[model samples]
Target: MPSQPDSSQLNNGSSAHRTLSGGGEMGALMRTIDWAKTPVGPVEKWPHSLKTAVRILLDCRLPMYIAWGKEFTQFYNDAYRSIVGNKHPAAMGISAQETWPEIWSTIGPMWVEVWQGQSFGFDNFKLTIERFGYPEDCYFDFSYSPVPDDTGNVAGVLVTFTETTEKVLLQQRLQASADQLTRIFEHAPVGIALLSGPELVYEFVNEPYLELVDHRPVIGKPLRVALPELAGQGIYESLAQAYETGQPYIGRPQMLLKRGQPPTLQHCAFEVVYQPLPDQQGQTESIVVIGFEVTELVKAQREAELANRAKDEFLAMLGHELRNPLAPILTALNLMQLRGTSEVERERTIIERQVRHLVALVDDLLDVSRLARGKLTLKKQRIELAEIIAEAVEQCSPLLEQRHHQLELQVPNTGLTVEADPRRLTQVIANLLNNAAKYTEPGGKVTILGERLDDEVLLWVRDNGSGIEPELLPKIFDLFYQEQQSMERSQGGLGLGLAIVKNLVGLHGGRVTAASAGKGRGSEFSVWLPFALATQAEETLEVIPNLSQPGQLRILIVDDNMDGAEMLATSLSLYGHTIQVAHDGLEGLKAAQSFLPDVAILDIGLPTINGYELARRIRQLPELQKIRLLAVSGYGQQEDRERSLEAGFDLHLVKPVDFVDLNTALFEEQP
Candidate 1:
């Protein structure tokens, strides 16, 4: 049997509790059992509400600590028990810092607040610990409330919490999603922005939108500070309408502003979608406005429309201006040729030249269209500067002789070479010289000079002629612009000569300039061209020559037009080749076999069998295969030459061919 415990130690234990019991209806009930002498034990005998409350607090999903003097206790519900593992019971009955030292720094202050009877709570609190010997960082929402004694003083703290790891992480994830979407909106191309509030403050602006005026992060700024150009444009009023009605407003492409010297005008198109931001109660708090800009595509479309209109007008005027003078001049030349040795022959030659000038003018107008559409291409080769200059001088010889001008030529004997399209370069130089001769008085001096300078070759045509006026010199290269009031205009050109010269030179990666000591003193036009370096220079010159020996060998001439074939065949027979003329390629092939001609002249456009196909068939005949095949056609582009070579022709010549060049080609040796 056990001895009785001391009564004085029991009386001291529950003195305060007995005092409260005396004032209540349970005071008489406590006296019979000596309430002051009750022993301290586990809280299993607490009232239902107290037990349920403590149970609820202990059952929380967060790790908790409660301390009463020296007796410290820790509890982890199902959620937090996993964190401590085998250390659960040992983790209990210890100070929070001793059990989870890593989290004690933050937990210490929260415990003080709870013990002092102040309620405390925190959301998304980070808890890092190694309680069970593994490190972890977790999120939690925690709260502490005091558990008061019957005397109304706090005796213990009720730590209540939820392991808000998922909730805290989920909330942070939502914020991160919002931030990412905001970044995309703020940097999108073509001026994206948001407008908010009644004052139209800019809530956000993207990188591109800010670059429209060179700023950074246009957040928290008034719209007017950046774009005062919007005044009276009704933008703000429209935004007010959108904000008030919760409906979107759209803006079509319109003029925005102008800036820069030579001041460029800006145009923009935009549409805004207005949205109402709401609270949890669904009440509107603010408005969101979105904007988008489109300008370049609209400008391109408008320019294309204008160019189409200009081309149509240019073609119509060109036809009327060119064809009107050709009829009488052709008729007079025909009559003069019939009376071979007459004074009328001289007059007819003048008429013929004037008619050719008109034809050239029409050709230039069409060429402008071709150049604009990227259709103009060149036939380039390494050529002698002297040869090119001589050709140009010869072409302008009649004009020089007509004006009685003393034309001089100066070029290096060793040959300064230029990479160029030969025929085009000849035309360019001839136009300059002819214009000088036309404007100069009789007996005026004209000189053509070529000199190598550094890596380039420069050619100059200078004349003691009536020069360009100072006012018109700037526009001399412009199409159809002439200095009509000056002596330079007496030449009566449509002003296309210099314009074509400039374009042709540019195509060869060269440049040209026209200069004069004011009007009438003199004028000089200089062309600068890149010359081939010695390493890449051509070694041999190509010459096309007529037969040097007298030729009575049989020749076959094929053309689609009867007159064209007969006339060419007759000319060849006079030059002493046994000639056979055929209007179609099929007949020409038959004549070629019968005559077994030494040479064949074929037109590319022929009925029944095309010249290319007939040439292929002729090559198949062993007897006629060795005979030369020359393609003659009005199609003279670079592509035409390539096609002719592919179709087995030895040479390709454009129509209305130069008789001298043809003669040279017919007789020239292959080597």
Candidate 2:
């Protein structure tokens, strides 16, 4: 069935060497092997097809081998030497089963199929070989092709192969990296999308991005087509600009209308960004869009603005209406006192006290509003702590006397100075004292203590009155918060005093805190202010002297309220000054020109024209230019004061003015 080599071929190694010549390293090894001891016998007696296949394998650069005859003996070239490792010269003439015994179970059947005239091949085929003295898992692209003899019968198996282990592993690693990136994009918090090409086609849309556009099917569709509502909104234009210039476009909160049922417009706001993505060639290729929905935040801000505007309007109206009535009442009381009527003197005093209390309530309401809006400005000056304490004591004396509360004062006489707004500081101290007096029983004791502690000045107000409940301690300084009181509401207040105290103290770079053991156990409030440096000079406090005997001068009073205007004219007339009264701005303007008055006290909300315009018209008259303009109105907000000054007023005073303050305004020199 097979040919065998003659005796000469078996003994001669040189003839076998000639047959395996030209292959690199394995060629030389094959030449020295003794072929007679192998299953295929000597080379000279081998089948013609076997010998021809060996010559072809030795000369080829690709890895190749031949398993011939019944033993399935092996022959391979230099390209296949590394594949067999140390099994070289010995394996040159060994059976395929012995050469790869570790993987024979897998490849042995393949050889049988080839021997039966069938051919087989595989790409990235897995196999375990022991050619290196140990087993190693490897992959290869290999084939088993049958070889035939001169009789055309299956005679041998020819195998061609190349290692593919490294290539396969590299591909697996790249796939893992891609999967990780996909996961990150899908779960991002902000809306994200990738658009490709000049048409701005949506290449990728994450879940957040889908929800931003009302969950419409947008992927693979152009942006213009996906969001038709954005046609004239400049969004599509912005993306195009980013792509063309390779620059990013950042957008602030912009209104976007969503599609909804009933054809009603559902508006929302979004902050968006479009960044251009560049290709390797340094050209813009696509755009990355990132968006954050700000509709709720924007809505909240708008509502806050509207609320503030409404509050400002209400406060203005309340001040004007309330102060209009009180102005005449207070002026009438002053006139009664000036007239020196002993009869009904006690009644007049009571009316004056109640009217002043109402004025304080109105002021507290406006002050809290200004503080909440951060519109109040402080005029800070260096002053001794003792001076501030004395003034606060004087202001609280009236309340303390009414309540019959015993008060104690404990404070350092000197070296405890602070840079602060004197008026605001006095208000803070007075509010604490008033709170203690009102909440305490008639015979309760209240103490005010002050001291210097480590770069700060500490003041404490302790009251042996109705102590605070533990649960309500923290919220005592909240605006409009009041303790539950009897139906009579003996503590007459709007509960804004403590809130004003806290805000004013904070503005001066200080802190305040309240503490109480429990209800009926008395409460203690502490205030700490940063001590001013000793090197700073202390400012001398100016006393507002009485202007009862001020020199007579021409004065004009203009107001829409007839009673307020007439009473103010009578008060100034009693000061031995010439007075003129006008019920409207036009009449006031005409009166100022004809009278050539030294001062014009004008109300803001006047008939015909407002005070601001009246002041402007007065300033326009060349002859009346030197006359002093005073604004007396209920609108005492900082902006209202600024507006009065802008309109050429020398002074801006709130309504229900004190007689002494009015006298000072009439006599004191303007700044």
| Best model number under TM-score | 2
lDDT of candidates 1 onward, in order: 0.66, 0.87
Please, what are the lDDT tens digits per residue for candidate 2 over residues 463-519?
998899999988999999998999999898999999999999999999999999888
Model 1: residues with Cα > 4 Å off, grouped in runs: 1-144, 147-152, 155-344, 351-384, 406-422, 441-443, 464-466, 469-475, 478-495, 516-522, 531-538, 542-549, 669-671
- Per-prediction TM-score to the true structure, in the order listed: 0.53, 0.78
Tell me the tens digit of each residue's lDDT in model 1 across 1-671.
01223546435546323332332222222223331122312333333333343345344444543443223344334454555654654554344556766766776677677668798888877887564467777776767776665556665566655677778778889989979978877766556666666566777777766666445445776666556666677765766776666665565655555332343545554444566565476544456655444567567767887777577456534543343334334434543564474767777777778766766666666566556555678878878788888888888998899889998888875558788888889989988898789878899999988899998999999999888778777898888777665664456767678888999999999999988988788899999999865555455756544465566667788887666666566556656778888888789889888888888888887899998898888888889868888887755545567888888888887554444455555655342
Best by lDDT: 2
* lDDT, model 2: 0.87
Clashing pairs in 1: 186-206, 545-664, 545-665, 546-663, 546-664, 546-667, 547-667
